[model samples]
Target: MKIKLEKILNLDDGEYRFHFETAARDIGLGLTDYEGHEVFDRPVVTDVVLNKTSHIYYVKLYAASDARFLCDRCLEDARHTITGEFQVAYTDLKSNREVYDSESEVRLIEIHKANEITLDKDVCDTLMLEIPTKVLCKEDCKGLCVQCGANLNEALCEHAVMQMNANN
Candidate 1:
């Protein structure tokens, strides 16, 4: 998505707000793209606000989606709530160079003398940061029995511990 600066670019100090939504297919996002990923029918919703105080312009982006993920242990369907919030600073300076420092906990994106700004890249980047390293269906997932490959959470297999013990 892109935001035109015809109204805000000329003003020395002002606040502007805009909102947009995108489908998973539109962004080329799929469940297989993530680890143990699952996806429900939900669109990504975003809210953005831009504020200018004197020479400094501040931007905030909020994005959220209802995603489904497979449980890391039992492989059950897990509801994943993914959300991202980003804060950035913009300056209306004439420059062709782009600067980024990944050391900061909160990343900063630079925008130079541009009449408009596209948010697709920034939104996707923020969303990537929200992905969890591990997804679990519950706090304690028993997973599957080693022998029968049955989900222990659903029903305990008769050959669960006994078979392994007898073999030892």
Candidate 2:
């Protein structure tokens, strides 16, 4: 979303809150999981807290969405609430001093000429990063039987029983 900085720029140093709700696709989040299953079709809710301290602006972003996907372990349909939170700092320093520090996350913006700030990419990146590498319905998921391709969490397959007996 593009946040207008007109009012914010004119106001004195203070904290401001902004809320936004939009479709996941609008922010370029129309994506699929690792298994090619569609996810996060629901609306994305974002809350921003912008702290204007002098020429520096600190923005805290919180976003959330409901998603449905097949469990990576058991391949069963499951639901998850995907959420992400991050902070970014923007400075309007007029000095020509260069910052060569690679560890600094501060961004420079033209406070006099810029009209608005677009956060679509930031929101997309935050949510994508928050997604679990291994999506699971539960922590201790039994997964599927290798031999019979059966859901081990539901019941033991014949091959699993035979394997267990052999091991014993």
Candidate 3:
């Protein structure tokens, strides 16, 4: 959602509050196109504080989503809860370029308008960071049968092979 901060920019020192619901699909993170189960019952909330003089805006976001992941070990379906937090600065495009801090992780946003800002990209970035690299049903889960391509987690296969005696 786009928030208008024209009023806030007009004042010497002021604060503005905004509350809105933006669709995940609009930001390209919709469950329909995502490679997993749908995300249900969730919305992204953004609370921003804009400083008129500094031309910098501080944004805080909270979001949650439900996702289904394939277990790395058992190959079973696993449900995961994805949540994340982000703090970023939105600066005016006309401001002098500042050197990035090597010691800290800070995302810089170039602001085009003094009173309007879009939170779509920020929300999408936070969700992407929440995705886990590896997903497993359990730590000790048994995988699938390599010979018959059967899932060992459900049942054991009956295929057997004769073993050669090692004793001479």
Candidate 4:
């Protein structure tokens, strides 16, 4: 979604809110999407809070969606609800200064001569950061047996259990 800040730039200092949506293509999720999940293809809801604070634009982004992934332990289908929040600062006014104020502490984006900004990259990066390093179907998921290659959770293997007890 592209948001035009031209009108907001002309207005007096204030805050504004805008709601936008994006498809997989817009967020660079067309191929090898976020964690290789097809669910990212669905439209993602994005909320932007634009606040004008002391001539600086503070942008707060919120995105939420459900993603599917393969469980690492049991090799089963797993679903996780992902919610990401990000903050950025931008100034529409021209500035020749090389350094920005340290108080804001957000990545500064130059949008002085631009009428709109596309949030596709931001959304993609936010969601990508949410991808878990390890995926699991459950906290106590019992994985498959090494000896017989059987699902330990579904059926207990007598030999496997005996071997574990003996080793302990």
Candidate 5:
């Protein structure tokens, strides 16, 4: 959830890679899906790349996690993989004031006093935005039988047979 800049801060212009795996809740992403299933029950895996160019640093964060949810159509337990990637830039300056620009995805920080950077908020927002609007067990789900309340994917219900006979 946090990247300690003690090493990267001193290194010259280059790309530094970091990898970590942590619980989703640690990054403030303990959430539930539309069906109330825990969306972040699995651990979040993150890969970070920091590119230092003189006083400017570019950061890219890639995060992924497996989530469990109830199929929207069949109402059965299903698994989904959620992923998010974000990029931001930071400028290290000797100025006393720190500035953040949401529109530009950039921030200015005082490198002399700062030892680390927290990415909890940025990770949370990225993962949350990637949650699927609709979840399904498969591409084609038969769902349930409206008349008999039975899972149509398992088997055809008597009501369906009767309705088909009536129609014919």
Candidate 6:
């Protein structure tokens, strides 16, 4: 979502509030290609504070999302919740034209006469950070049987034990 900051940028001390909802699938997070695999179904509330002297824009966002992931253990569909609080500093491109370091965390956006700003990419990034590297339905999931590919969560297969004993 883009917000016009004409008034906020002009003010010496300004507070701007934005509320909107954006689709997780539409954004280019590259989380999943399957439709409805991951959905961000939460309201995004952003508070922007501008410091005209320093030409800095401070933004804070509170966002949440729900995603469907295949559990690595059981291979069953699991639902995961993603929530994040993000704070970022943005400088006006016209006046504060400084090169950013390769490892700099701060994101810079070029501001022209157009006072529009996009929060989509920032929101998506925050959500992506919340995703866990490994997903499991339960902490102690038994996983699938290596021999027959049977879901161990439901029941253990005797063939798997024989296979393990033979290998050992």
Q: Indicate which candidate wins on TM-score.
A: 5
Model 2: how far residue 19 lies from native, Å: 1.3
Measured against the true structure, the TM-scores of the candidates, in listed sequence, are 0.72, 0.78, 0.59, 0.76, 0.85, 0.68
User: CA shift at 59, candidate 5, in angstroms?
Assistant: 0.4
lDDT of 4 by residue, 1-168 (tens): 777767666767788898987775677855443456584646778899988766677788998767777778767777787779988777644351224545554544466556676777887788878888898889888887777777776877986779779999
What C-alpha lDDT values do all the predictions have?
0.71, 0.82, 0.59, 0.73, 0.82, 0.66
Candidate 2 vs candidate 6: the TM-score winner is 2
**Per-residue accuracy of model 2 over 24-73 as CA lDDT, tens digit each:** 88999989866786688789899999998876678899999988778888
* Worst 10 contiguous positions by lDDT, candidate 2: 94-103
How many residue pairs clash (N, CA or C atoms closer than 3 angstroms) in each of the candidate models, in the order given?
A: 1, 0, 1, 0, 0, 0
Q: List the residue pairs that clash in candidate 2.
A: none
Clash pairs, candidate 4, are none
Model 3: residues >4 Å from true position, as ranges? 7-22, 30-55, 91-115, 159-168
**Residue-level lDDT tens digits of model 5 in 60-151:** 99989998878898889878998999998887763311344544656766657777887878878898899888999999998988877899
Q: Is candidate 3 or candidate 4 better by lDDT?
A: 4
- Determine which window of 10 residues in candidate 6 has minimal summed lDDT: 42-51
Instruction: Give a tens-digit lDDT track for model 6, residues 1-168.
Output: 776667556767555566666666555555662444543443333343333445666677776766778888877877777777777666665345354323344445555555676777877888778888888888898899877889978976998678669999
Q: Give the TM-score of candidate 1.
A: 0.72
Candidate 4: segments with Cα more than 4 A from true spot: 30-41, 96-113, 157-168
TM-score pick, better of 1 and 5 = 5
lDDT of 3 at 102: 45
State residue 71's C-alpha deviation in candidate 4, in Å.
0.6
